[model samples]
Target: MTTDHIGDVTKAFIDYVDHNALHAVAPENVLIEAFLNATAAEAAEVLAHLEDDDIERHLPRVIVHLIRRLAAAHKNPTPDAVAYEAQNPNLGIANQPSHLRIVKYITDVYTSQIKGDLWSVAERVAADAYTRRVGEDCERLAQIALTNVTAAELEHHIKTNVERWRDHGKRLRRITNHDNAPTNLKAVA
Candidate 1:
């Protein structure tokens, strides 16, 4: 996607958070900073605006989904792909064992079957096998390719995100007075 598209998506995400009051639920600055410095405050602001229940249930899933999507988009072959190339005769020779080179070889195999663009049926099948065998290992590695994040980083992320949410809860209680609301107002109001 273009930079403009990414920016637009980011803006829309922020707007969604604001509209939902996620910031009131989960101030996300620290967690956001952990992901990307530019989106830190904006992400926190968005998280702060969500409902507590919604934030608890959905935020982690959203983050994981985003990570997975990014990972898939930038995914290249892994060491397994190199091994596959080494074993396969029709794939020819590969002097180096680099991930990109292996991925290219896989892509060539994929493209050959389609008779069109460089797509990889073999790679897809292998990916499926990897998913079954490694149980998200390839996907995790793929996500790592998209960002410099690590499992240890994610542990920090969990802690920060939780703290932000808790802080938002405290702030929300201090900011709102339920008893002072007009009696005539509906519960949904």
Candidate 2:
């Protein structure tokens, strides 16, 4: 896909994340700027090489990692700054316990909805549900610009996921019914 398309998709994914209530520790705008700044044509090319199955299986991890990095950036302005300083040891080693807890929470919530074999339609449905919720929350955050939240970050997250699903096309639709099916009629007795 072209860079413009990729950017559009990224935006949609971020919007989806904001629509959902899932909280990211990082400021939304900063996170989004970071993602946009880090991602390039090469990143999209790398994503393109991924099979649908792989994308489906690993998207959650990608999202979690992205959120973690964003959160870290928020807590630690400098590269050497420690994240979650409250957990830092006397020796100055930052305690990873809080980070781990947050990561675990994100994984738990994401996987709970997207669990099961990739081939299963239920898994796709679950993944859609998960993404949809995230999008909704992101949108909400964007609208309100809640304290400690950044609209841009939430928008970026939603855009990314939306793009992924759009790229998968048939694979995603196969697991979903976007249009309402026609109802069957009963014969008059």
Candidate 3:
């Protein structure tokens, strides 16, 4: 809620803290550092509010108190509250057309060598492209960073296919999340 002075306002700042919690160090030096940068009086004001009981509750209280002090220090971000997008389009737009060209060219090459089913043709094209992209070190770990993930390709194949089972969402939709997940079983023998 907005107030004339920040010290009069109340808010739950758990969202920011929770989002960054996985990467944050215990006692939250990252958050403390942000608080310290605001001012000494602000630091004392915030650190005084940190609850030291159950850490699940305590850490978030500390984070919220720290964030409030930091917010009070600055001019508000987006004081005008207008949204904006990037002025320039990214190179990925250019890259997508080139990707389609590569797929078309490779598919043609494989088709000429032997007439086959569309599925086999696509698989061969992908394998050929992979081999051509990485000559010798196909399975090497260091090369994986340079490799492109075919995130769309498999989904595209399943979506466009004639088989009813191809729609994995409908075929495999869970009644309850992870209720169907397999657990490790040890033999009693």
Per-model TM-score, in order, reads 0.19, 0.20, 0.16
Q: Write the per-residue lDDT of candidate 3 for residues 1-189, one digit (tens) a residue.
A: 346445333233555555445334323323333332334444443333332221223333333332343344542212111011111233222222333333342233223322333222222333333343343333342344345736575445434442423232222222112222122234459
Error of 2 at 117 (Å): 2.5
* Model 2 per-residue lDDT at 62: 40
- In model 1, the runs with Cα more than 4 Å from the true position are 1-146, 178-189
* Candidates in descending TM-score order: 2, 1, 3
Return the lDDT, model 3, position 144.
Answer: 46
Full-model lDDT, candidate 2:
0.40
Clashes of each: 16, 41, 0
Error of 2 at 16 (Å): 27
Task: Judge candidate 2 at residue 169 and give its lDDT.
Answer: 55
Best by lDDT: 2
Question: Of the pair 1 and 3, which is ahead by lDDT?
Answer: 1
